[model samples]
Target chain A: MGALNREQKDMEEQSAKHKVVHYPQKKNKVKRNESLKSNAIAWAFLFPFMLLYVWFMLYPIIQGFFTSLTTGSFGMAREFSGLDNYVRLLSDQAFWQSLWNTVYFVLISTPTIVIFGLILALIVNAKLKGTTFLRSAFFMPYMLSISVMASIWVFILQPYTGFLNAILGQLGVSEEIFWLGNEHLAWISILVATLWWTLGFNMVLFLAGLQDISEEMYEAADIDGASAWAKFWHITLPSLKGVVTLVVILQSVASFKLFGQPWLMTGGGPGDATRPLVQYIYELGFIQWDPGYASAVSYVLFGVMAIFAAIQYKLLVKKEG
Target chain B: MSKKLNIKTVVYVFLILVTLVSALPFYMMIINATRDTKDILMGFTFLPGSALLENYRTMMEYVNIWNGFKNSLIVSVLVTVLSGYFSALTAFGFAVYNFKGKQPLFIFMLLMMMVPGQLGLIGFYELNRFIGTLDTFIPLIVPAIASPFVVFFLRQYLASTLHPSLLEAARIDGAGELKIFHTVALPIMMPAVATMSIFTFIGSWNNYIVPLVVLFSPEKFTVPVLMGFLKGSQVAQNLGSMYIGIAISVVPIMVAFLFFSKYIISSISAGSIKG
Candidate 1:
């Protein structure tokens, strides 16, 4: 009887050990299941957006590529024209001219926008009294629609009785500049208007970047007897490298996609001088009713943009190896 | 040492001058709006004039300005709300989920964000036409709802700020997933929601191309499209009322920005600078 009782106690002890060993495993299994369930729920939430993106953006992008290859005959039939449209685009004077115009606008407007933006940023970052009001004032233009800015500037830049010419007159300059009538002057006018309209955005971006720099960096430089110029060059410039790269890339992309300003301000110009590639594509597609040709032009623009974006990514976004 | 003070003064002067240059066009727009048509044509007006009431009347009479404002407001509000929710949901998914193809999908979203707006214009127009949504506001609102920038922005916010452990804790408490999202995740995402709302609002309010192509009727035109039509029409040639129209279009956005400049500035800084 004693031996049987001892054996029963040993079995009971072994059973208790087994329960302890299996308890955490069961809990872990339950946890793993719960995680899987949560993941499923997450995917369910994401599903709708995935469908929308695929249908709206991805599908259209793919269709655009295919449409570029076809002679789109009002959606009735697609004649496969292999590389024909691309070949024709090579000799298209309007395309080349518009491309050149876009490049010119980028060259003129980008640096001006960047420099002006940085200046505004520096001022706002100083946290002077009434800086909030000034910041709001500086950013107000960016809020205005491009169309409104174009219209307002149109009035301002009017040649005969325009405000700009009137100001020039007051300064003893009798010459009435055809701001939007002359080819070169029209481009310049558009550039000036664009610079005013867009400077706010870049300013905000630069301000944001500037604020990210630790105040300690400036204090440290001050302790070293650094001049403001020295501090700006040594500290501010280097700290802003990332943001500057971002601004350059963003501004470049924006400049490359120039459409509304030129379209509204110059109507593609005083003889096509201010017409950018997108505007050309727009006129081709809507105004001219040549979707096939327009599609081709758009693809070429995309190719150029892609190349620019690629180079920008390569230079600006290269991760350390 | 005094030379440094002189240089600092010069720099301040230079900054003020540039600020004046920046402020010039806006000043001109206001001045021209207050001037008579004759004064506008005669040249720049530096002083305030008495044409504000008259110009406002003329502008109101000339264009369906109220309708345009209403349309812009409706469209912008809808875009802000819908896009914000959708973006937050998608961001939540990308942040919390360990699903198949998650990394690839997120990368694709990032890639799509880089594509220029004009790239899809023709295709998007044709798609709208095919979907029988041409000449409607759906074309404007729907596509914008799927903004890649918003998705990318929200995703970054979610991944960095939202704690997965909180989600797990909720799950362990037997809270349903949707409930967890609503109860747990959303309140914490206010900053992101605010940021995206501003961006989407600005984009929708300023949209021209899609609306220009889609909405043919003048009554349906948003502010930008109406402004475009106004600029193209004979009424747009009237220097006085045109400036007034420009002012009317610009004022609302300025007002909104004035109220929310802090949020706007902070959000822009956080999104771009941090990224």
Candidate 2:
């Protein structure tokens, strides 16, 4: 099926090229070297930024890799232990727990965001009244800082006195759930907060993807007496395959690096239920002052994300090929 | 026709429901800030209350919210300007130049973007200490100056929007490379710069981990650190004070968004679509 699509695309490109070749006079008149020199001037303009990048960004990252190999405190680093950090990380229970938490977050949050994002996209794409207002309203949460998100949700999830529990009490539910205080529930609360905060971004991406689908496809579906569900299942889903893949991969990578939300919302509290891998590494490195072990945990995370990224790249290239 | 109406109604209902879910927590936060802590604990107050002044006073006294705001503004603004300009330059180089090792350099930048910032926490802290920049805003502002996202976004925008002929014409007018960049390319890239400026501003403003690790002084703490402090402090443990802090932190970003909603949204959408 993929090969067939590629063949069709190639044929379309060939025909388009043929049409372009028939109009060669317009293409030949454009001067090339003068443009190249102008580009060189643009390059010169960008030099300072490049220099700063090397100094601040590139240098720090390279230095960081080297520092990760040292066996000392943050300021007292000098001696190297080779792969000792990576070796130690293999036995750390906290590292494994954090990795588990990160995976769970990605598994739960990515799908929810993608599905909800698609649903929201479809709704807004229908051109309802106050669509623009609704779009802005939905996206408003994403504008808030992660700090604000954590603080607000912390208020809402305050065990006995919180707004959510209070509302639940009013609705005559007997049990007052300690949403952020329980081991199992803490991760859920963080996940809920994350979903609310980030769903808008994914929704916007899906909405853009939806807009890119030609109107002619929908018109064709209408003429064929297609039901709304049928049209969505056949046309909309297929049209959004590329975007869906991209969003999934992006959100998966993002969720794997989950730190701010878990840090702010629960502080990986109630016994590490919400402690993701990056947060675990952070705690080890900064809080516990164990750079060697922390570096190992970070490498583990990097390895996991690298695997996903590699898969994503392979799929993307395969699709293109 | 009935089917169309049904779908529209369903769509509207679903959107309104989700929007309410999205907006309600914020609304509740505002309302809680207006009420006393006792009332907040007793039940969810649907109506606005009279404890707003008291909560505001308490929040100010406890967290020094104004100082936090100032620190956050200073750091975010510096980071945004420096990072945005430098990233734009890097993007321009990659987009327009045929320099040696450009491809590898570009790939490295992309890899930098993908790597979680937390991975470098230990290394960065150690480096900052060696450089004697710990507990200072320099660490916060300096590293941000090489943002990979801004570089990547600016490169894509320049690739799509910039006309090569315009640069050629500027060259033909006897303009030096720097002069052409300053006089011509920079102006053309304003929209892209503005888009990235907002993102950089938000990222820097919301930055918690870097500030948490580096800035130990209370006065130097950004809003996120201050918020965390408030969460842990005795007086700030009260729901009302915490809500107020959250409200204070959210307002500036909200106001910025309201002011530049259209441009910000369009630019973001454009970036995502191109990706």
Q: Highest DockQ: which candidate?
A: 1
Error of 2 at A259 (Å): 1.0
Q: Compute the DockQ of candidate 2.
A: 0.42
Tens-place lDDT digits, model 1, residues B1-275: 99967966786786677668767887788788898887777666579788888888877776878799999999999989988888788877766665556668767777777787677777777788789988888978777777777876666666556665676688789998788889988888878888778878888888877788778888999999999998888776566788888887777777777788887877877767535
The sequence of per-residue lDDT tens digits that candidate 2 reaches over residues A234-287 is 999988887787688779888987888888888888788788888887788878
Supply candidate 2's per-residue lDDT for B88: 65
The candidate 1 chain A region of ten consecutive residues with least summed lDDT is A1-10
Error of 2 at B162 (Å): 2.7
DockQ of 1: 0.47
User: TM-score: which candidate is best?
Assistant: 1
Candidates, DockQ: 0.47, 0.42
RMSD values for the candidates in order, in angstroms, are 10.0, 5.1
Q: Name model 2 segments beyond 4 Å from true.
A: A1-46, B1-7
